[model samples]
Target: MTTGKEYVTAVFEKVKAQNSHEAEFLQAVEEVFDSLIPVFDKYPEYIEENILERLVEPERVLSFRVPWVDDRGQVQVNRGYRVQFSSAIGPYKGGLRFHPSVNQSIIKFLGFEQIFKNSLTGLPIGGGKGGSNFDPKGKSDNEVMRFTQSFMTELQKYIGPDIDVPAGDIGVGGREIGYLFGQYKRLNGYKNGVLTGKGLTYGGSLARTEATGYGAVYFAEQMLKARGEGFAGKTAVVSGSGNVAIYATEKLHALGAKVIAVSDSSGYVYDKEGINLETLKQLKEVERARIVKYTEHHPNAVFTPAGGDSIWTIKADLAFPCATQNELNAADAKALVANGVIAVTEGANMPSTLEAIEIFLEAGVSFGPAKAANAGGVAVSALEMAQNSQRTPWTFEEVDSKLYQIMKAIYTNSAAAAKEFGEEGNLVLGANIAGFLKVAQAMSAQGVV
Candidate 1:
C-alpha cells in the first residue's frame, strides 16, 4: 500500500518530532534512513515489522550527574550519558568520549552510528556509547585521575566484561582508561575484560592505538584500488592530531602518500615536505600540547589558527577527516572537490555534513563512509576484549595483520552491497544497507524484545 520512500519519510518525521532538539542524532538518522529506501523497497517485511523505528530508538539511556573536585578544591559538575542502542548481535560495545563538546545528541549520534559500524566489522558486538561533558584538556594528571575515578565509581555499576564494554574516544585515552580501570578494579576487582584500550601492562591489545587510522587508510586504499589506482605518491591532508589523525598520517606515509598537513583544536599545520611523525607524536601524544606548537619543531611548516575555514582548504590528492562530527562542511567539501581530491575517507563519526557528502558524490570522488572507514578502532577494541576474555595478549604484527584483513573485508562488503543495490560505487548507501541488514536480521531473528 505504501512505497518504501513513504515509509522512510513517515518514520523519520516521527523521529524528528519526538527528538526535535537532537540535531546531530537526527542528521545521522536521516542519512542512514535515506540509504534504506532501496532495501525497504525490495523487502517490504522490514517496513511491516517497523524495524527502522526500533533501530532508531535506543534500548536504554542512562543520564546521571558527575561531580568531582578540581585542583583548586572547587567542585565541578558534569553531565554523563550512556545510550545502549542495540544488542541483537552481542554485548553492547562502544567507546566513552570525554570532551567539553560532548552532549546527549552527540552521544546518541555516535551510538547510532556505532550500531552499524560494529555490524560492518562482522563481529558479534552491538552498539552503545557513553561519555561525560568533562574536558580532559589542560588538566593535570592528578586532576584527570580524580575525575576518571569519580566518573567510573558510578559507571562501574552499569558496565562489565560481558555486559557493556566501553573503550576510549575523543578525550578518553590510555591515561583516562587507566584511571577508570583502577577505580573499576577497586570496586569490582581485576576485570580486565570490562574495558578495552588498557595499558599493555594490563590487558591492552597491541596495535590498538594505530588501528583506527591504519584501518581508514587501508579502506581508502581499497577505494582507490577499485578505481584502478593506489596511494603511491599521493598528497594527503588529514584533519585532527589525536590518535586517529596521527596514526592515519603514519599509515598514509607508509603507504607512500605524503601527508602534508595535520590539524588539532587550535587549527592545522601545513608542511610542504610532509609532516614529521616523531615531532607530531612528541607534541600530541607525549607532551599533550596544542597543534600550534607543531610549528615550533618544524618552522618550515605553516600553522593556521582555528575559526576561518576548517581543514578542507588544504589542497591534496586525498582528504581524511579524523576530527569531530560535522568538521567538514559544504564550503570545505567544495574546496576539496575544487582542489581535485581523489578520495575522501572518514576517520571520525559523521565528520562530513550531508551537503558535503552529496557534493563529494556528485563530484564523482570516491568516498569511504565513517562506519566502514573508521571501524578499525572498534574492531581492534573488540580484539582487545577477546584477548582479555582469553587472558592472552597478541603481538603487534599479529594485531596489525588482523586489522588489515578486517578493513579490507569491510571495504569489500560495503562495495558489494552498493553494487547489489544498483548504486554501484556509492559506499554510503552500501555501508548503511550492509550494516543495517546485518543488525536488522539479527533483531528480526530474536523477535520483538
Candidate 2:
C-alpha cells in the first residue's frame, strides 16, 4: 500500500541496511531508484512483483584469490571479484578492471551501472563486471602477463562467448587483454568471443579502443545540436590521459573544438595552444609516460601537479570527465557552471558525483550521463561479439559509423524517455527509466527465479 516514493524509499533503505559498507554500490543504486519513482507510479505491477528488490541484488557474485609471482620471484596475492548483476536481456557483459581500488563496492557499482548502460545501447546485453585489486602500474610485461594468466585461469571457468563476456576497464588495456585472452585460449582453446578489447592480431574489433571516447563526443554533439549549438570554435577540458580521454579529445578536435587540457593521476597538462594529440599518444599510449612528460616534449604547455577534479577550474566551453568515479564534486560543478561550460559529457563511469550533476542541470548545461553517453563502448563490444560469432571482422570506418548511429539512437531514446516522464532534458532520469523498463519487462516475462 506504499506510495511510489514510499516504495522507492523502502527499497533503498533495505539495500542500504544490507550493504552499509558499500558506498559506491549504494550511490549507484540510489541514483537509479530515484529515477524510477515515475516509472513505479505508472506501473504499480512492478512494485507488486518486487522487481526493485530483485533488480537491486546481483544474481551471482564470485570472489577468488589471485596469487601470482612478481619479477623478483616473490609471491603476491590479490583479491578478484566478479558480479553478474543481471542477465534478463542477454549475456552478462562488462569489463574487468585491474587496480588497487578494485573492491566489492566498486565492482558492484560498475556492474550495476553496466546493466542500464548496456540496456540503453539497444543491444542484447545484460550487466556484469569483474576485476582484481592487482595494480598494473610499474609492473613489467612479464609480471602483468603472469598475473593476468593466473587471474584468467580461474575466470575462464565461469565465462564463455555466449554467457558472460568481460572487456577491459581502468588499469586494463590491450596488453592485459592480450595476456588474459592468451591464458583463456591456452586453457579453453581459441574462443575469440571470450573477451573484447583484444589486439588487432587477434579478434579485437576495429575502433573498439576509441569507441568510448568517440561515442561520448558523438553524444555530446547531438546534445549541442538539440540546443541549437555545436562544438565548433569552443574550448574544452578533458581529464585523464587514458584511452577514453585521448580519443574523446581527438573526436572533439575533429568537431572543431579545441581541447586545451588533459590529465593523468599525477597531474594535468594544459596547452593553451591546444593539446597535441600526437605528443599525447606517444607519451601515454606508446611510452606510457606521465602527464608531466608532456611539458618536457612541448615547453609551451604547462603541467600543473594538481590532479583530479582540479581540472574543472580551467575555463572552457565543454567539460569531459573521462577520469575516475566521483572525480568531480559540487565545488567542481560550481566552477564549471560559473565558467560557462556549455556541455558536460561523461566518458567515464560515474565520474561526476550526484551534487555535481545537479549543479550542471540547474545551470542549464547539456549534461550527458555516463549510462547514455558512454554506452558506445559496450555497443561496439556487442558488435565485436557478433563479428566473432560470424568469424568476420569489420573495417574501422564501418565500425565507427555504426558506433555513431548507436550513440545517436541512445541519445534520442534517453531524451524521449525524459520528456515522456515529465522531466524533459533530464537525461539522467531518462536513461535510467528507459534502460530499466527494458530489463524490467524482460525480467517480468521470464518470471521470478
Where does candidate 1 have its weakest 10-residue lDDT segment? 306-315
TM-score of each: 0.99, 0.99
For model 1 the local lDDT of residue 6 reads 97
- CA error at residue 29 for candidate 2, angstroms: 0.8
Give the C-alpha miss distance for residue 178 in model 1, angstroms: 0.4
What is the C-alpha lDDT profile of model 1 across 321-399, one tens digit per residue?
Answer: 9988998999999999999998999999999999999999999999999999999999999999989878888899999
Off by over 4 Å in 2: 307-309
Tens digits of per-residue lDDT for model 2, 1-449: 66789899999999999999999999999888999998989999999988999999999999999999999999999999999999999999999999998999999999999999999999899999999999999999999999999999889889999889999999999999999999999999998998999888899899999999999999999999999988889999999989999999999999899999999889898899999999999998999998999988899998889644488999999999998999999999999998999899999999999999999989899999999998889999999999999999999999999999999999999999999999999999999999999999998899997
Candidate 2 lDDT score at position 352:
95
Clashing pairs in 1: none
For model 2, what is the C-alpha lDDT against the true structure? 0.94
